[model samples]
Target: MSGLNSQRGVGLVEVLVAVLLLSVAVLGFSALQMRAITATDESLVRTRSLTLVRNLAEVMRAYPEAYVTGSGATFTTVLPTIASAVPTVQAIATSIAIAEADSGDSVTIDGLIISINGANNCLSTGTTTDDDDNEIPNKLCSINQLAARDTLLVKKTALEEDIKLAVVSCPADATQQAIQQQMCIITAWNDTKALIDDTDTKACANSDGVYKIGSHCLISEAY
Candidate 1:
């Protein structure tokens, strides 16, 4: 009987040990799963930001005359408000509310033009001459800029909850001719704002325009 009792105690100890090991394994797996989820979210947002940046860049290239003024020789400063770039300006437009009527439903929101700096519409009456001295309407001359503006506004309105955009000049100061041609299209999501054209210690980008550690932002240099 004594031998039997000793055997039973040993069995109980072994069972407790197994349970403890199992609990630790389960906890480790949970931690790994959480980390994977966080990483996936980060990657998804970065991809979306890249897409938005590329789209805007292409649009700007298409609208070569859009940013130029004064006989189409000088570049117009698009971003008049420097301070508004860092903390993103909140733009308001007609709101569209969509409710899920059933599974596999489709929703479309019509474009509501948002004016920047109280600028006139592209279709407004204005004309400029091309290199060949061909008379061009303002709509044709600045179509690229208009397209870019429309794209930014529409994307902002649709993805307002997911992302923020600031179309700022690259050098911020635009002092030099080489740097004056570049523009910075910054897209940020979830607690990350790209560094403005300044040397702020807490900003995402450094003086060299490189992304710093722990800054959640994607900066694209557009010509």
Candidate 2:
């Protein structure tokens, strides 16, 4: 009788151990599944953000005239509205701001800003010439036609640099030109530090907006 009782007790212990092990395995799987779901959600958000940015860029490119001449104050488009499964599509705008730098006849091209609700304000600084002229021609002429061509070159460089820096930092993810413009501003600030030492004012005059150590043009506007 004593031996039979001992065997029964041992079987019960074994069964309890098996149940505990199974519970641990189940919990581990649940944790892994949750992590995977979270990762997928993050990826979807990033993709949506990129798509929104690209759409705005395309819209801006399509209306070059509107962008250049600064015709209408605002441009708007309706995105395809989707259910909760995906992000709500939104129309975005590429805002262009041009501003004159502290020194030099060069102009800066600030990058674009994107909005989700289509109610965001985009402010851009006006571009100025060496003569302190704020009128930026719709079409840039050759150096012979107008000395402002050099300023345009500098502006273009600043815009391109902003894009490149953003691409490097984010890799596959797309970012609005706003961030890139900010980076260019910092770069421009650093470049201007040595301007006081230079006596030659003709260095960046006729050439394109490429900024060298001694001879550099400031970017006045971004499109």
Candidate 3:
């Protein structure tokens, strides 16, 4: 009887050890699953951002003059506020929203890098004062005031890519040349990225579904 009792106790100890190991394995597997979800979410958003950049490129190619400076010129990006949201602006913005919906991503256009001009140069003086008397970083253009040959060009670049576009001259072709020098449009948007902590990414806050995050602007003659 004594021997049998000892054997039973040993069996119980072995059972408890197995259960503990199994619990640890379960917890580890859960963590791995969470990580996979995060990775997948980030990948989808990145792909969507790429798609947006490409679409903007195609749109501007058809309307180069609308965005770039004439005579092989290019301008820097500026954010413009809405003076009054006109029907034309609405129509254009709507088109982009529709495209995003079709692509299964929810990011929308949030920034416009409008082109600015000054005396005989597309580049602006860093110390120039705006009408408000505040020293501005550079001349940034408005979005709503686009006119003939003026543009709202959309471009995409990687975060690791150049912050400002390089010195690229427009080709001789009239259509290509239109997006040169002082006239240009560069747009950026927000998109959601995966989060391990999920604390402060407003774009992705409401639900697990993707939203907009950072902005990336590119110029004509850029890739």
Candidate 4:
């Protein structure tokens, strides 16, 4: 009877050990699953940001008149800054008037739509000859600035709430005209925390257009 009781006690100990091992394995698997989900979320945000930045670049290209003055002239006015806290379409639209004015286009900020000289429609080329038979120079709402503003406004409204966009001078000390003409579009979002040892507040980026350790942002250069 003594030997039988001893064997029963040993079996119970073995069962407890197996249970503990199973619990540890389950916990480790759960942690791995959580990490995978986080990675997938980060990837989606990154891809969306890339698409938005490229689209902005394309929009700028389409409205070359908004930034270009002559055959080879560079951008005269700087791009507007979009803060992460208040990423509103009207904010972006209202701030673009400087560029519009530089392009010889008078614009009025009315809500999200920037009316060039109070014109409702900007599709018109606005290229018409006056009674004097002289071609109008930089005609109002000439699809130069107004269209750009309106299109950009629409795009801004479509941005995800979690994503933030900002415009900065890339390569802060670039001397070449080509580099100087280009602007950096930064798309930033919250991701995993930095390593415990990392201690950079501007780890993601800075006004000087530099990315440091633990950065969770993407930069795209646009002209």
Candidate 5:
């Protein structure tokens, strides 16, 4: 009887150990599931934020001149002002800030900023004094021109690829014609020097010729 009791006690102890082990495993699995859920939520938020930022960028790019000329109030009115523009602009100013603030995982709210300084160009500078005794410089026109060209080229290339793919997949489709026309226009605008000439002489010489889309000389006296 004593030996039997000792064996029974040992069996109970073993069973209790097994139950404890099983409980730990279940808890671990629950923790993992929670972590996965959290990660997925974070990813979704980040994607939404990125989409919002892109929309904001498009708005600014659409009206590049307006962005340069408009006041803070104008910007707020043009863009969705649910979040202030100043904070959004600050995040874009620095790479680190962009990385840190852009993540949807961050508890802090994210924002978009469009900063356009008419006085300072993205390229090089020329020194001058304004009415307020503030020294100013004209930004390098060449760099801006090149950047614009590059942007257009990238867009054109992507559009051409899509058109080619569509045409291949549907040979007789009328959509191909529109894409083809667009491609031709892009090519003409990019390749024609008369269209993008910034110098006064070129502008004067090409006054009667076909100019590029948004050519400063053709569109406005200030550009």
Candidate 6:
């Protein structure tokens, strides 16, 4: 009878050990699942960012004229290359997009679409004259041009604190001269993680908009 009682006690201990191991396995699996979901979400956000970058580049390529001349105040002026991609430009575009998306916010703000010279603003605002400007002859809208048309939110996408269009100039042979400029564009977004770490960033005193830390993605292209 004593031996049988001892054997029953050992059997109960074995069963409890097995249950604990199973629980541990289940917890590990749950943790892995959560990690996978986080990775996927990050990937999705990155993809969207890339798409936005590409889209802006294409837009720039199409309208090289808009970025020429006028302190960028009148149009997307072609100031000396400060950096590729202007922070203010990216911020204004994103803000305008979001505002347009939100029904309630749409009315209070002037629409992103603006009229130039009292005319509906085309993707290209004015033309680079065939004779004086480069032969491309396509025109760009200047800041003053937009003003002539309507009130704008950001006036040539300029910001007091947050804007610098990085550009690199290299000596060009004949073909290179045609595509002489490498322009930089930065796509910046508010980084919650960065904001959380330094709460004082809420002020953004140095920058006109939120400081996203490394959240900006800059792309430069010669066209």
TM-score of each: 0.58, 0.31, 0.36, 0.59, 0.30, 0.46
TM-score of 1: 0.58
Model 3 deviation from native, Cα RMSD in Å: 16.4
Q: Write the per-residue lDDT of candidate 4 for residues 1-223, one digit (tens) a residue.
A: 9978766645777889999999999999999999999999889888887877776666655654343222111112322231122112222422432343323333332222344344544555656788999887544444344544554443443243355565544655343333124756666677522111125574455545556666777878777
Question: For residue 17, what is the lDDT in candidate 5?
Answer: 98
Across residues 1-223, which tens digit of lDDT does each residue of candidate 3 receive? 9978766645777889999999999999999999999778656655555554455444434433333111212232222222222222212322322222122211112233233131322244567778999886664323323421122222113222211221222233223222222222232224332221135553222223222345222223332
Q: Residue by residue across 78-167, what tens digits does model 6's lDDT show? A: 333533333223223333332231122211112233432223453453445465666463444344233322222332232221332222
Instruction: Give the lDDT of residue 2 in candidate 3.
Output: 91
Model 1 CA deviation exceeding 4 Å by range: 9-12, 68-145, 148-151, 154-158, 171-180, 197-202
Backbone collisions counted per model: 1, 14, 18, 0, 2, 21
What residue runs in model 2 are displaced by over 4 Å at the alpha carbon?
1-5, 9-12, 65-223
Q: What is the lDDT of residue 214 in candidate 1?
A: 77
lDDT of each: 0.51, 0.31, 0.34, 0.50, 0.30, 0.38
RMSD of each: 10.0, 20.0, 16.4, 10.0, 20.9, 10.7
Model 3 stretches with alpha carbons more than 4 Å out? 9-13, 67-178, 181-223
Error of 6 at 46 (Å): 1.2
**Candidates in descending TM-score order:** 4, 1, 6, 3, 2, 5
lDDT of 5 by residue, 78-182 (tens): 232222222212122111111222221111111222112222223444677789989887544332232222232233332332211000112122232211111
Clashes of 1: 1
Which residue pairs of candidate 1 clash? 63-144
Better of 2 and 3 by TM-score: 3
Runs of candidate 6 with Cα error greater than 4 angstroms are 9-12, 68-180, 188-223
